[model samples]
Target: MTPSVQSVETEDEYIHVRFRDPDEFDTIRTPDWAAHAAQDVSEGSEVRTGKQKDSDDWEVQSVLIKKQVGEDKARDEAKQIVEKIES
Candidate 1:
């Protein structure tokens, strides 16, 4: 996992994760994951997931998180995204 850390935010069905590197930064989206998790989510809810810092790149981190969805469902979706990224 990367040492890089970021803040996460969700808007509608979209997720926005921001990583800070000063010179460079990255953001990841999981609309498909959100779609699946959305089924159990209300119109406005906060969903929190987990994030792992990269071992190699200190300025990089991999986060599998979702917001605006049910905890159980959002976790499931986050797991799916993690699996896909790992694959």
Candidate 2:
């Protein structure tokens, strides 16, 4: 699937890049939020999923992109996500 940007809601010092995943329900992989953010994503480029904490609960927190962001660029920002995770 070609990755595309989705709804974004920013507050104070945080910006969320919500990925559009339709079939995410069938596959659930809890990515390492901090590490993924640090190595792959850029600053202010926080990742968020629709997966919930529990069966009937909400997700814990949005994933983060640390140490890579430099002033927010669209193309560079897209490069900071793990496209595939081998389980």
Candidate 3:
């Protein structure tokens, strides 16, 4: 099943991409791959996605972006990344 961004939140330099009832696409690999792909976005930016707690799911994740980037762009970028990865 395809996953959609359930919610998007922004912090100082981070964008959290939370999936809506994710299916098979939700795994350690999905977040790790996205994180790797996200880091290539810029020189200083970084991304992270993993289980904050062992009982939680990987669908809830976060990506760190450059401060100058807008939340809309960040979400769009994340959507592209997720689509590319899922395809």
Stretches off by above 4 angstroms in model 2 are 21-30, 43-46, 50-75, 82-87
lDDT string for model 1 (33-77, tens) is: 443443343333222233324323222223334455544554444
| Candidates 1 and 3 compared by lDDT, better number | 3
TM-score of 1: 0.30
Candidates ranked by lDDT, best first?
A: 3, 2, 1
- Candidate 2: minimum summed lDDT over ten consecutive residues — where? 57-66
Candidate 3 has which clashing residue pairs, if any? none
Cα lDDT for residue 28, candidate 3: 39
Residue 36 deviation, candidate 2, in Å? 3.3
Question: Candidate 2's residue-wise lDDT over 1-87, tens digit each?
Answer: 435555444544544444544344433444456345534445445444445333543231333333333225433454345353211
Clashes of 2: 5
lDDT, candidate 3, 44-87, per-residue tens: 44444444344555443444555567777776666655554445
Candidate 3 Cα lDDT to native: 0.54
TM-scores for candidates 1 onward, in order = 0.30, 0.40, 0.52
Please name the candidate that would achieve the greatest TM-score relative to the true structure. 3
